[model samples]
Target chain A: MSELSTAAAVFISIGVAFDLIGGLGLIRLPDIYNRLQAATKCVTLGTCFILIGVLIQFGFTSIGVKAILCLAFILMTSPTAAHAISKGSHDFGIKLWEGSVVDKLAEDKSKE
Target chain B: MMKKMLFHFLMLFGVWLLFTWTLEIPDVIAGVIVSLILAVLLNSIFDGEVTSLLNPVKLFWAIIYIPVFFYHMMVANLDVAYRVLNPGLPIKPGIVKVKTKLKSDLGKTTLANSITLTPGTLTVDIKGEYLYIHWINVLSDNVEEATKEIVDKFEKYIVRFYG
Candidate 1:
């Protein structure tokens, strides 16, 4: 394989490892907020790295350009979706983990 | 109005070219026709002067912002990965409210997204000048310090264009 392909392979491997860790985090985390933190950040970065690898492997061809576009789409949308889910769960009265150290939102709401 | 229409047409045509990745005469003709029609229909939805998108200063900051954002994202991934893999999950998660200096919707949204993707913080909601964030590790209960840590980094760059 070419040097470029070797580089791509390295990136793809890193991405896959992060993705596996993200899944493990989802199962191990204590509550909805914690799980969202693990799942969103790790998986989003993992997928971005995978897309970067694809772009590198494909060069500037259509496939490479599409990979870049997918990366942009994911970067913009993934966090927004996670933010929406967290807000929704909070509004639905889902409690934070018992070990949580603070609840400023609750305090703010109670103050009004 | 005409400028906005032209701007939208060009933007849509650029996407069409990216999607098709072809330069055949027939493909060009179809793209032009489709984008022109859509541009006219969608131009009203776009607020502000479309010319602002072409500003050199704003464009320059945007270029600079991408790398900084990506670097933070990489750091965040590694931090979370380490926390997830550790035998004892050492997390002190909490939802805390932090204030932002950004006034524009665009700036605030970008700041929130940046915080969510950065180390140990996920934006829960935005209320006016304040953002309620779910921090994986609550380093400081003080709103000013948390804002200094989380919002200031991205806001410095984001304010240049989006603010």
Candidate 2:
């Protein structure tokens, strides 16, 4: 196998691993907020790294640029989208796990 | 006028580099013209929060911050994975309001975004210096520790950048 092909395989494998890790996070985390964190950051960063690898394999063509553009868009938008969704869920009053240390928001609001 | 034009031109130049990956004269000219048009349109529509592109020092820091964020993402991912796979619902979920020291709107936004980005926590709302976060699990019911973990890692750097 060529060096480039091997590297590409490695890149794709890493990307797939990130995606799997994200899925696993959703399953393992105690609640929704935590799950979103895994899905947004670990998965997104992993995909970005994998895409970069693919771009390197493509050797700086328009296709490579497109891959980079996709990566950039993901970086900018994913967290924002996740934030919106999580906030929406919170507004709906999704319960947090049983062990909670603080309720500062409620406390501060009452003080005001 | 010249300074404004140069600023717009540099932006266009960056776009051109991203799009075409070429430095040929035609590409540079095309980039300059397109950027000028964009600048004019932006100048007409833009209001509030103007930032300069020539600040290489700030850009250098931004470049540094991304990798740091990546590392945090990896850690969050691992933490979440362990929680999900554990047989016991050993989860402690709650919403806590933590005080934020970040001042700028952009800085706050970035901080909120990062908190939501990390696994096991979400930013529910932002009011003044306080962030309402819904945590999936409370490792030890230590809201202060959790707040420190996030604010120290994410918020501080975001303040350094956009604030």
Candidate 3:
């Protein structure tokens, strides 16, 4: 196999591994916030690596640049977006896990 | 005025280069012309000259702020990952309204986004000057301190950047 194809295979495999880790995080994590954390960070990073691989294999300059831009966009936006959705869910009043150790927000509100 | 337009065009040209794989003269020239037209059209629609490029100081600070944010995001992700996989439901979730002194709309929005990005918290609503956040752990069972942490770390930076 050519060096280029080998590089492509490596990147694709790394991306797939990240995606799997993210999926595992979603299933294994306990709450909404935790789940989103995994989904946004792991998935976004994983996809970026995968796309970067594709960009390398295909020497289309425009595609590579666009993919890099996409990676940047995801890095910046995904966590914030997930945060927004989770916050919205929380504001609507979701229950926390019973094993929770702190409720600082709740305590401070009472004093005020 | 012309230089500002030229820079905007250049940025677009860079974008165009990413779209087309060639670095030939014809492609470069075409990219420049198309980008300039786009800039002109955008300027007209916005009813003013776009001048984000005019502020060198703000631009410089943005470069500094981005890396700090990335580090914080990574740490938050790890924290959340541990909690989610912790077997027991260890989250103490609740919604609390945080009264913030940040006056600008950008400040409020930044505060909201920052809170949301952290591992255990979410920004639910911004009603007037109040920020409602839903936190997963709540740290100390103290709402005010919890809210303060959100405002201090994320909102403060955003206010400085966009406000």
Candidate 4:
């Protein structure tokens, strides 16, 4: 009921909402690339917000410091993992959705 | 070489202190030993002037960049959420190549990561000076325009430290 806890609760709620939207996007998006775009951006920020909320609730305690460290690790690693997955799938010849506007990578490869 | 080793040692020891969160004599001694060993083994990985890590101007810019990055990331999350909730699902996805003036590995990697987290773009791969990004909305097919839109915002900040 205190102001601090209320602030934490609000951030936590927003994080959960983003996470749910990311999950919905994974199912609703038409292709792997589109899915990666939605899932990586939303889920990363979602988890980061949750960690921020935890940090706020715990202050500078060991648990709070660990939350910040975990947030940094996720921020650095999540997009790298997504990049690797997208690159791997593209190399394996997975086709883009027909709605895609351009395929610059494919064009470059063909030209080579 | 000595400076690089010392820099690495300090960084490693700082992490060790954070993990243990106790300043007992025994813990400090153990941290120093472990950090020294790792620093000796891994110092070669750092190619930049190790002293640059301590530069005040660069550190200031790096601190400023954190909030800028977080703001863009929050906006990008909301954008993705909107597209997900929209009934029409207004997205025109594609792989586009964008150029970067940043030649250093650290700068390029950081730029690519920033691009992945911002707006509707996800970095697929980096080839030479060009980064291939999967864009959810195809606003422009030209290399200059795409680069301007995706890389320019972060590039200016990143160059201050990494350039």
Best by DockQ: 1
Tens digit of lDDT per residue, candidate 2, span B1-163? Answer: 5566556657666867788878789987888788878877776454323253246766666778888877777677667666655677556666666778877776787788777766567787787887887666655435577678657777666655566
Predictions' DockQ, in order: 0.87, 0.53, 0.34, 0.84
**lDDT of candidate 3 at residue A20, scale 0 to 100:** 76
lDDT of 2 at B57: 69
* Model 4's DockQ score: 0.84
Q: Whole-model Cα lDDT per candidate?
A: 0.90, 0.71, 0.66, 0.89
True contacts kept of 4: 0.83
Put the candidates in TM-score order, highest first: 4, 1, 2, 3
RMSD of each: 1.8, 3.8, 5.2, 1.8
**lDDT per residue as tens, model 3, A1-112:** 3466878889889777767777888887666755665676667667877988978887656667778778777766875787667656655666555555644344544588
Clash list (residue pairs), candidate 4: none
Q: Residue A31 deviation, candidate 4, in Å?
A: 0.5
**Chain A TM-score by candidate, in order:** 0.95, 0.83, 0.81, 0.95
Give TM-scores for every candidate, taking all chains together and pairing residue i with residue i. Answer: 0.95, 0.77, 0.68, 0.95
Off by over 4 Å in 4: A1-4, B48-51
> What is candidate 3's lDDT per residue for B56-155, written digit by digit as tens?
7766766677777767765765666566556774666555557777776655665666556555566655668776666666654354775566666765
Query: lDDT at A80 for candidate 2?
Result: 83
- Tell me how candidate 4 scores on lDDT: 0.89
Pull out the clashing pairs in model 1: none
> Share of real interface contacts recovered by each model?
0.84, 0.67, 0.42, 0.83
